[model samples]
Target chain A: MIDGGYQGKILRVNLTDHVVKEEALREDWAKRYIGGRGYGTRIICDEVDPKVDPLAPENKVVIATGPLDGTTAPSSGRVMVITKGPLNGTIACSNAGGYFGPMLKRTGYDMIILEGKSSEPVYLWINKGKVEFRDAKHLWGKLVNESDQLMREETHLEAETMEIGPAGEKMSMIANVMFNGHRASGRTGVGAVVGSKNLKGIVVRGNLGVTVADHDKFAEAVRATREILAQNPVASGGLPLYGTAVLVNIINSTGSMPVRNAQDAYLPEADKISGETLRTRNLVRNEGCSDCSIACGRVTAIKEGKYKGEHGGGPEWESIWSLGAMCGNSDLDAVTMANYLCDRYGLDTISAGSTVACAMELYEKGYMPAKDAPFPLRFGDADAVVESIRAMGEQKDEFGRLLAQGSYRLAEHYGHPELSMSVKKQEFPAYDPRGIKGIGLEYATSNRGACHVRGYTIAAEILSPGLDRLAYEGKAAVTKFLQDLTAALDSTGTCLFTTFGLQAKDLAQLYSAATGFDCDDKEFLKIGERIWNMEKLFNLKSGLTGKDDTLPPRILNEPIPSGPSKGEIEELDKMLGEYYSLRGWGKDSVPTKDRLKDLGLEDLS
Target chain B: MKVLVLEPAKCTGCRACMDACSFEKSGVFNPLDSRVNVITFHEDLMFVPTVCSQCETPYCAQVCPTAALVRNTTTGLVDFLKEKCIGCKQCIVACPWGSIRINHLGKEIIKCDHCSGDPACVKVCKAEALTYVEVEDVVASKQQGVAQTYRRIAAEMVKGVNP
Candidate 1:
């Protein structure tokens, strides 16, 4: 048995055979991989075949949390859902913050591996050591909030739930798995994989405690880090006061907000839908995830519009941009309503809004037939924005089904795939790569395709004092370093926001105290480097190559039309080769055997 | 004497207080063992962090068969003595607010002792939802909060008439 930070059990559920078995967690693998994304990806790489279809029964979903989960370590409540994603058939891992991760840890298991497919719709109810597979046929078509309530009524009242809505039920490629009906594992169609298995959701509750190896040391580490976070202006002041929507004004001022499907990089009236505006008009209160002190979550309501009384958790910075500026709509009410719809229907807001923006462009350019659209699909039409979200969520019509396939497929069908503003068939987020150069490199090299959280170079390029947003020099090394560090941090079950105040050494201190492992900053970062290489190897085996590592043509070729970054374009080619060299990859962007062996992955190579 | 004051509007439902309390009491992190609990009503967007009120006429102390639950006059806290108690669970059943609960192991009763007069929950509460302050200061601060709201309303009235 392990000393602490692990329950030493892995729960494996085979839906096909209806078997629930408890397997001992591999101690050696736990030591090396750590947990969450790292350990979950290791299991996937070992058990799953790269060539298998992502929606097939052979594709397994590993729901994992790290050693810090359930501990008093600040914001240590993130859970990762790792699988062969249906979005691009890549190894996808999406994490969300809530009570689910800590509750799962209390269930006497470090991870839950879901295998095979069920003949009928079902949900898993895990109460401490007991596991129950219950029929969910009656609840199959319910929305996220309704299903969450129903599942909890069936199980314990206090049980934490993770479920999907109609998007997942229909296996939309941009589906999300929502926890507590609000927090989303919101990328790369992990929800579609869950739906393909005919599993509706999982409810978990337990009474066990998570013990640390050194209690005094862990407490001291937590106290120090908490003080640091409390003192940091971004963490304690801006975030709690205005929420992440604060970035709307900050990024817009920098001319990187990606307005109107990235036809332009800035919106002149951006502050109308910014964080400050949201707070003054719509905010009811601030909320937070479990164990988090920096409560950046906005509990907002539309008070006096047609969508009045519609309230929910957030339309955070990315969602605000995607639904507001990307659609060329300055109506905050419409944006907030659409954000609620995305969460309720279990859709990834970034992909959903971006896809709609592409459709609008297609319609406006006369590429898409007027007969194909239910109404005039024009930019800045608030009603159309709301209607389109409803259509995509419910799949109400033929046009809705087409839109649900995501922007890449939708744009390709319209005969101008270049208009999709995406990389590797996944849509770009709020930031325009043309304005911010380092983030462009990150999006190109991201294992999960065009994701911001994989490596947020924006922290360096825009938020912090390190790098210039418009420059191409020195971006390669920063991107690589941030990517590696992020890979490790995501595994630790801590919020990425913590990095604003806490450094690598602080994280190492917490991890070492909890797990009884003496890890310094260098070793901690090395573990992250190992995970990055492992993910790259998985992508290579799945047939992606150096040629696939590229930004959208629009970002690389077009200059911002107006604003502070009016003449800027992303110089990705200048950074990619240097990034590859820094990562110890070959010129073709593949990890060398020597680097794999150095990371202790010789056998896999 | 000091009392634990809970301001429900300020709680974010992070449950850091619960984790701190449980760890200080049991050396492990579990909300089930926590003396303080943040009850969440997600639909209403409300969180109430509940703790023992340490009532002057303690129901738990009166109900205890062995007098294991007693009110400490110095700290104004309801102290639980494990050694003096039998596992009768009378105090658990008699608690009107349900502040007292059976341990996770179902062996004995557990209630907030205010961390022996230095509450761990208050120190870690970043939201300041839970504050341990002198009893006399609590009402004064609460009244000041209401007066500020009235002052804002009166200023708004004046501006409306002038504009």
Candidate 2:
């Protein structure tokens, strides 16, 4: 039996059969996987057929939280949405921060397994121990904010919600599950999977207390951890003051801010869309997730513009870069507006913006016909960017329909898949791999495909005690270590930002105190390695091979045009080979049998 | 006497105070069990942390037939005596700010007793949205804040006229 940090219950809902079953959480699995992404993905690997179509009825979605969730641990309110992602056909786990995860845990369940497709639109109302399938026909096509309000009204007033918007209802490949109508589990088409199941949303409220095994020890651990966070310049200063868009100018200065579909890595006017600019012009207030101290979330409004009076959660650094510089548009207002629309529409801003950037590139190159676009789809056309997002969200026209399919499909349709700036058919985030080499490898090998949160080597490559961003040497080991560490960290139901001040030992201390596990830093990272190898096995079973572990040709071939890291190109091959060896994987990037045995994951393999 | 003062403008809606309070009181983390609460107004971009005012003439103390709820003169706290509570929710209803609540188990009334003088909520609030301060200081701070705002507005008006 688990001592603490868990509700010790799992809710399995079969939509097709209209069955809601409650089972004891598998203590064995909890012990090994920890929780959140690790525990959720383990369930997927065990239950889901790797070869199953991601959007099919056979596929399942696991909504999971860690032992630390709802606890005093700093920034511990992350929810992981795990599934076979439609976007890249990979094992996808998108982590989101909001009250939802903690609220779900309070409902006496650590995880919710959504299986089979509902015949009609429906939402789950989980009020403590009781679960009900509520008809959501009225909420089917509503925006996330509207749905959130309606869900609250239908359930408890204080109920937390996770919902998909019109984009998800239409099964847009770039759709994401929006928590509290703003925070997004925003990658790899988790929302499309929900839509395919006709699951509109989930409303949860609970009054139960979450206790830790060693309460005083846990409190002490939290105090120490929070102190570290308070002292760290990035965690206490940059993040809270400027929000995440603080990275806009920082990354640009590194000459790795992907611009104009990554045709350029730098933009001279990048500061116009930066965090400092956002604060001065658009910031309404700073917001934060449950139990967070950093308060990096920005609540912004577009005042005195065409999109004036438009207010919402964020244009976070990635969103700003994708919607701003990636399309070669420096209009901060347009970017902010576009970000707000994406939130309402429940679209992944990175994918939506990057896809629009891809379309703009295609249009400029004459690959995309002018008649296909609503307006001149040119890079730097702010109006066009906003229009394209609307069209894509609504799937309004033929061009909109194509855009909904994500950049890879859209670019492939235009017979230039190379222009997608993607790995595994998912759009790359803000960073230019040519300028920052390790992240390219990370993007290429991320289990969910082209994601940054999986392993943010950028913290090392660009942030404090910086590494040589252009160097190919030592990046492989650094990338592998970070990936393993992040895999474990993401599983802990904590914000990735906490890593700015926290190390494995700090996290392990919190975990041990919470769950009565005597987990050391070394053992903690081993668990991460196990989770990583488990994901690799799942992908391997899903037919993703070492050949698929690659950066886009543009990143590998093209040198950065100009700026601080001018003439730099990602030497991916030099690092990837070393990465494979370090991971105890074969040349084909397949985890060896002996390595699996060592990690005690042989049974999984 | 020190009272729990809240600055809604400084609150980021993190609910750390709630967690800290709940853990301190009940040895668990649950907002439902917390004496302090952070109410979020998402559209307005505001968060207001609410707690027991420990009113000078407490309505909860006034309404209690059993005198289970009484204001402690020393601490300025409207303390809830559980043995005498009788599971009566009169204190909960009497609380104007809804600061008093039933325990998660619905067995008894729970309210802020100022964490026996060193408010746990205030200690955990990194944003400094919550503070335990002398009542006079709260009013003084508010006046100072208002004065600063007026000064800024006056400066802006002068700039407008000069331009």
Candidate 3:
């Protein structure tokens, strides 16, 4: 009996039996967990076995959209996709923003649970209150763009779709699920899990309208939130003008750009692959997700040169860092081409580029011979980066196979596990942990393997320049608070970028107005803490311990060689004890029974 | 006279304009219900906003059998009148831009009516992709763009011969 801000329907599709079941969304769960990532993690923890193979039929993939979705709330377009990650063997909660999320919500369901594996390639077509399992043999090997066009043609409707490309079909661990053909639920190998289910795509055409509890109150809350977003420089000016790639020169200047597979922290030619360069040379225009005032999505083009006419949504800040500085490639055109191909082939650009960087390091170290690679692999080889990404997407050869296993395995194969620059079998994003100590702690303690979005301390540490990023003293508390807030925001189905301008109180106001739930600031933060602990409980049950909450030896031991943070190693251990204590976790990094009882997560424990 | 103008180059294809238009017009947030459409050319890395040109001789108004589509003299917009609409969709078939859409309940075929002169789409367009400007200014701005391209080519030619 969900009242407002919810469709009150949970649609579960069992691929094995081709059965579609509609069940009542639990009101208690909705009130407690909210929705989106909260709904996903709880459902996955209940349904999936800890020891089950991520790609196995027993595993379930839950797609959850929160109450604010399909509403006029600014940037409330994010959709969370939760599953066991094939890459890191951890609970994966990946969020993607685009039209697909709103459309999915409009289908009169708050969540869609995908269960079992289909024997043949198939796609789910969900219209308003009706679900159909359609044959997708024709769309199996097609890339996202092509498959999207095909699906639209087949459906004869302007359907919002989430599709996978060749990379996912081939089961690349770095594969990502693409929404609206470009925006992706990218991290932790969610696409590979979809591939394992033999699901080609999910096309949704929703005609029903989403209604609010009190339209006037909701509108006022949205107005206040949008006003904050409009006034914030990062949200309104820098983001809209330069997209996320605006961080390139700034992060590079701080010596946290992670150049040449963390061998160096700065790229000499950083400006060449900067947001300023992209705006002047390659920018087609700035776009945004549905109802997003901060149009941070870059539509860029390679106007001339070798990779001429190549264009796509981005190589955002992280992608640019992974494909450019980290690989020592300064050519913006090459980076843009790699970005397009990654989107086209449905590959996670972060893992794809980071793995290539690892291989480049292996090649330079004389560990990976030239004969083993399709071409001579070297740092700053722009064309090599472009081709290798395509090769990895297409699973080109033995080289492609090696690259598909991701950096951890690739570096381990060369007998240098420490050189992989990863944690928990997942590659780290652009930020070098050594330069930003708070980020290092966040990465180590992140429930998911190494990821920046889980808790983006960069906003305070480097981007805002408000905090002492070099000192690790009070960062643990900051990191833990951010992580909880982020987890809660992820549950609310809003883009994490909104935090740049609006605070938890703003979102809480919006939530209460939309759903008629009377939640104060304390209750809001508590909900976030509860969600974070629930995820930790799931991980603990899955056999992850305090020992697993750690960064790689390179990030912890190696001093950043150049730039502002020169000769500084990450003090992760200094923060871990505080972080664990603050999180109400024991010395083993597991939530104690008493702590779980406090959050009402004792059942999960 | 002023008219809604679209600069495809300025569009990021975020669909904020679409969402706002739909919400304002229909009291709901749905991209498909928006009067304006954003056509994404993903491979080419471009977004072309397809909006009502509000032409002098609108095909939609001309094709409407019931005179539901009539030009509003004040705003120079071909506004839709719900009372006169027969739900025949003749205007939908005739519009070249495909900007007209059937409302969620399938009652009226609605297009951009400029919201009685203060267009919601234009008001929310952050990229300035959609604007309401005098008709002559639109052509003047376009010509300036063309002139700049020609001037650049001419300068290049002069440099090539002189050097």
Candidate 4:
């Protein structure tokens, strides 16, 4: 089953016919796309109809795992869920890391592709070599935790379940299928596709373990990775202790922690909602993904207060920004509770909080009366934040429905679309691109709308790659390289955080060993470029263009007003030109024929 | 009498015990198939590991239909002999604490042997939950736990519980 240590077969579950078929491995596609988000986008764009309504039953959800998956490789417990997002209305490929990917790998399938809507609410169970769809009508409209509980009861505590909550079942655009309690596939709203299919959840359990083709060599590579990571203080020392919350004070001090929905470039409440605060005050424990040593995933709980018993899928940096500063809510307990609600309801905290923020601005501006709206939905209202999150879970009432659609559509409905901090219908994150130019280019180019994790540029523009600081001139070159590197990492199903310690050459070396393909650094980088261009081509074919590559009006028009990044505006026109030129794209930002030919993609398009 | 001395505060929930037992018995890494189960009541962020006490009157070994399981004389470890085992899961049902499990997928019965003398799980546990302390020391640990609880209550007092 493994030539290069892989399951060799991808499972296709046609929910419409209740068909669970095992398909042969596509060696060529695996070679070109690698896996995870890379293969996800390629398969979706080529196989599924672009015109299929994102929320409709016809749309397909192809869950992909990479070649490195199930190995003792760090963070190989990652998987990608790809479909048309109701939030962005584009190619939504969201990646998550936990025990699920490894379990699926043990179940003897490289990937699981869910196609067509089922007759009724049902969940697919994969037990070692067995696969089946069982009735889930009784479990419909449950939260992610509730679904997990029900499935575990039915499967007798043997299965690890991945399920969406009521928000997904209701087809809420910002929904995510939470993995366990602390980790999530927290972006681009793939949960809506899961909901649309009437597939409530997927539970997998297996006793089988993977065999690395060359176990001795694989062991060496894993050890080398640990050695590299051990030196990078960020991954080994800092992240394990503080998690990604390590960025809070730094991003704030640099004026990159976007506050009050990007109107302010820094959060004054930086100390309250920071990673340090989380560690000292709220952190209950920390855990790792399958076989990972860096256990950065935080388990936090609010203790001894009104928000007592309030816990988290732990508030990540983006969650801290979106639900914390973006809404002007500083109460740490409330922020933790909001984070909990997002995971419980299986909603994306970024889109949910920013959507509510957009409405808050509108309400403040007298665009809508508070009486007509749900709560006094104003900025900095803690009660309102909690209530709005509850309403999102319920998926009832007019205001909740609007917020469920995410910020882009919510603002557009009020004829104040410019107020929405978004690109491609997904809301922008904490980094105000106007303050930092490279992130602006990255947001416009990211396949899944307004995503930062897709290609984070804060490394070069703010926190510098080699711990160097603040270089703007050569950032275009740096961002381009990192973004492609990120694309490659996602394809390989490795955590993007690994890039902090692991060099491209190491990744290339590991990739060759894992896939049984001799891919040099150039070959790897080409695959990354190919995925990026393929995603761009998917967007283009799905009716997006260079015009769409433009940032939100506020980001383009406004300066930081006052901060370290004050007087700075996004040099978008200049950066986009150079980026497109380097990417071998036309003036319209579509990949040129020459670029496709060069990347061995001529046969593809 | 022998007993498990568990320190709740020190537990990190690495589940190394499950790995060690499954590896020796099934020759695979499976937490589900392990005998000494860690009942992690995660809402409390607490790990309450349920293991065999190796009681003076062993209920499971006493009631085994095939007499497949028995308490060792020298070490008092509750060991299961696969050759003697009929795959009848009577001991699993007879045990009150649920520290026994059959292979969930393979349908083969399993239980903890505590590694004869030097227990592998106890040695491997980063948390030190499974200690191979002297049989007499178990009483002293229980006395220490009670004394600590009394100190905690005394520290918290302005008033005692009303009669």
Candidate 5:
């Protein structure tokens, strides 16, 4: 336990043998990994064989909470679900902000590792020490919400559940495991890994509270983090007020918002799904994930006709842009509805929308016909966006099956892979990297394909928090620094939002206080660097090359059609060299001997 | 009549109250064991918080076979008298809110005693959903909120706002 916090035991569930084991967490691994995404990625990379098929039962699914979880730590409600991704064919680690992370820790486990496929559909239930696997045949065909309701009814009362939908069961390459009230461990096809194991969901309830190593010290450290957040206008003010949807208009204004399938970097109708619109129209309430004072999770509603009586979850900035502008659809209700459908179907809305947007481009260029597709699928058709989301979930029709595989493959199937926007096999998030040069390099170098959370360079390039690297000249250095810092934060089990309010050193203090390790500040940054390198090493071992570290053709070649960033295509090669130089990598992008030695990884190979 | 003054609209569903109650009573984050509880009854993604409404002429205290509960003379708040109390769970059966709980109590009836006036539930409420208010003022604001919602709908309809 953190001197006075929760015990550091990982609960391992072997579905193949119906065994629940509690393994002691390795302190060294914990020190290096931190928690949540960092810890989860490390575990999956170390335990699961790289050669294993993404959809095979041999791949292990790891879920973990970070160190700051279950405490009074601000925005520490995020949980990470790590696995081999069928979408990118590499390490897939996804995270979502919700109550589940702290709930899992309070449920008396620092992590939950699911291994081996069950012969039949099964859902694991944990109530403190009592654990059991029940036949989930009845829950098999149900949607995420229905599964949760049924599980709660069967369990004799309220239950916190994580359940996959039909997309997951179908092993859709872009599926997700949805939690209560629509929180999700989305993207990178982690749900497919769970689906491959015939695992439906996990239900948990616990009676434990965190105990930090040193109470006064932890309290002091935690207070410092709060102080940092208190000063950060973005976290304490902007996020808590508008949620992430605040980024819609801001990014659009800055020409960073992706529009018309990343071909354009801005859309005029972006205000339709902007945070201002959400506040005036859709927002019902603000909810937080576990331990988060900054309740960024919004409970939204579509109050009018068509999408009325349909609500909950959010059309957050990414979802708003990805489902709205990227698809060439600017209808607010349609964006909200599409997001709702993705959540219910337990699919990654970003990938699902990107996939549909790619399909629309294909259709426009005569790659696929409107009649052959399930709906009158067009770029700006809001109805088509909603229908296609359903089609992806059902996975019955031919095009639906292809769309479920995500954008990269969907475009490849239609003979226009160049039209798809992704780095490494995964679809892109909201930003059009052509506008923000550093972000393009960040996307390319991300271990888990195209992902914004890998390194939120927008903080520097767009927000210009401390230093601005808007141009490509010094972007590589900043990208590497931010990635290392983000990697450290991700591992520390702290919220990225906390960074807006606090610093890396503050987070380090929390870790040291909570764990009673007397962690040096310099060592904390080193921890993040070590975690990033280890994941890179894992991907490298799995046959990824420096060539895989490149953006889509759309990003590299096409000029952004409009906005302040017009005529700019990402200058990736120039930044790549600088990024490599700073990261202590050779020309080939492999970790150098000094780098490996720095992270104490000389014995790892 | 001590009833939980609830503002569902204000509830963030953070469950800080859950931990506060458990920490004081059970020394853990045991929702099952905590005397005071909160639930997020979601409809249209709305968070509805439910807690013990210590009733007047209390159904639970009135029905208890043992004199396990008594009202405070000044606060007029219903409270658990652990002394001269047995773990018969009669109060648990009689309470309408399902707020009365035995919670593994061996020989004492457990209930919210308002933490001697500074209700722990109120102090730590992240959403400010609950308050141990004075009896007469407990419900006026909730009625105002409901009326406001309807007024908003009526106004919006007249404005001819399009979907």
Candidate 6:
């Protein structure tokens, strides 16, 4: 029997058969892989076959929370969704924050695994230990927020719901699952997989309370962490005031903000859409997730104009880069509107915006005629960006259909794959690698595709203020450590922003106090390393090789036209060799047998 | 003597206050057990804290047949005696704010008592949204807020601007 921390139940549901059952959580797995993304990746790797289509019945979607979820620990209201990515055909693990994670954990379950496709639309109602299958045919094809509201009204319970909008129902490769109507488990098309199962949403409500292993010790650790966060400039001052968009000006100042579809590393109009501008022009207030002390979530509003009274969660730094700089649109109002549409329609903004950017480049290059689009699409046209996003979400036109295929396909459709600034078919975020060496290597090797959150070594390479932003040496080791630590942190059911002030040691203490396990910083990092290796194994089994661990041609070959790091191309080959060695992998980037044995993952690779 | 006053504009909707209250009374971390509830209007971008205002004439106390609810003289808060409660749930319906709730065992009513003048929720609120302040000071501060807003609006009008 599980003692504390974990709720000790793993719920499995087969939508095809409408069969639901619970399996005892494996404590050994908890000790080895921890939870959240770690547990989700491991479970999905074991159950889903490498050859199965991500949108097929064989594909499994596992949603897992860690032992620290539902506790008093800061930012513990988060969950991980793991499945085969329909976008890039890679092992995908997406994390989202809101109330859904804690509410799920309070139902006495560590994870919920959904398998098989249903013949018709359905929704799952989970109350404590019982799981009910409710018909959602009427709720099908609704917007994410409308679906959430309808589900709550039908259930007559104050339940936390995660729903996918028409984008997912149409199976757009970049469609995401919206949590609590706003937060998204965005990236890799996890929502498309759920949509393929004909499951519209999952509603959960629980009253059971979580009890910590050592209450006093947990309290002390939590108290100390809050104080530490309060002292950190990024966690307290910057994040609370500007949210994640705080990085817009800083990264731009460092000449690392990717602009105009990677044509430039510096956007001259950056200040027009920067976080400071948002604070004065759009932000209504700062919001937070469950138990979060650092309220970094921004609730914004478009005060006046064509989009007056329009409001939503945010246009984060990535959104600003994608919808603003990347598309050559400097209008914050248009960016904010696009962000809200993406959220409501369950679309991944990075992919959607990058696809539009790619289309813009194609149109400018005369490959795709401007007349073919529903509107006159051009760079710096905020109206075009807004209309294009709406058209894509609705799949209304030929241009919309092409753009829905994401940047890789959209760029290739016009015979210019190089225009798509992506790795492994997933769009790159705001950071330009020419100015940040660690981020480039991290992007190349990230199992889930080109993603900043996977291994945000930029935290040290750029945002640290005093550290070397362009150093290639020792970056391999640092990126490897960060990738592993990020994997561990993602599994802990806490927001990664906590790393700004608290390190692995602090997390270890909190986890130990909550779970009654004495894990140290070194051990925690080792667990993280093991989880990363496990994901690597899954990717390898799915036919990805070391050669796949490379950046896009444009990013690797082109030098920054003009920036602080002008004339610098990514030195990827120099770091990839060192990274492989540091990770204890062969030159082919496959984990060695001995390395697998050490991590108790002998049967993995 | 003081009462819990809420400035909802400053709330982040973190729910730390609920956790603190739940831990104080139930010895566990659960929002369902917390007396103070936070409701968020996502579309409007607002957060409102729901707690007993401790009205001069508490409807919960007046509606009670067995007199289970009574005003505590020291804290100037309504206190519930579970032993005297009949579980009729009149207090639940009578509370306009829906602040009172049934305990986990469903045998008694749970409501805020200001934690005997040192509310756990107020103590944990880092945003200073929930403050324990004197009643007169609360009224004066609200008046000051209105005056400040009026002055800002007048200044904006003088400058030929509208927000």
Name the candidate that leads on DockQ.
1
DockQ of prediction 4 = 0.14
lDDT of 2 by residue, A208-298 (tens): 8898999889999999999999999999999999999999999999889999998889999988999999999999888889899999999
In candidate 6 chain A, where is summed lDDT lowest over 10 consecutive residues?
A: A462-471
Q: Native-contact recovery for every candidate? A: 0.70, 0.76, 0.60, 0.06, 0.36, 0.63
TM-score against native, each model: 0.99, 0.98, 0.93, 0.85, 0.91, 0.96
Clashing pairs for model 2 are: none
> Candidate 5, after superposition: displacement of residue B12 in Å?
1.8
Please report, in order, the local distance difference test score of every candidate based on alpha carbons: 0.90, 0.91, 0.85, 0.76, 0.78, 0.87
Q: How do the residues A117-183 of candidate 4 rate in per-residue lDDT, one tens digit apiece?
A: 8989999888876988999999998877778778877874645678898888998888897665445
The C-alpha local distance difference test score for the whole of candidate 2 amounts to 0.91
Task: Show model 5 residue runs off by greater than 4 Å.
Answer: A219-232, A369-371, A464-466, B1-5, B24-27, B32-36, B50-69, B74-85, B94-96, B100-126, B130-163
What are the candidates' individual DockQ scores? 0.79, 0.77, 0.49, 0.14, 0.32, 0.62
Residue-by-residue lDDT tens digits, candidate 2, B1-163: 8888888988999998999998998898989888888898755668999988889899988999999999888877888888887766777788788988777787768888887778888877889999888989889988998999989889988889633
In model 1, chain B matches the true chain B with a TM-score of 0.92
Greater-TM-score candidate between 1 and 5? 1
The alpha-carbon lDDT assigned to residue A34 of candidate 1 equals: 84
Off by over 4 Å in 3: A369-371, B42-45, B51-67, B72-79, B133-163
lDDT value, residue A357 of candidate 5: 90
Candidate 6 positional error at A273, Å: 0.7
Model 5: lDDT to the true structure: 0.78
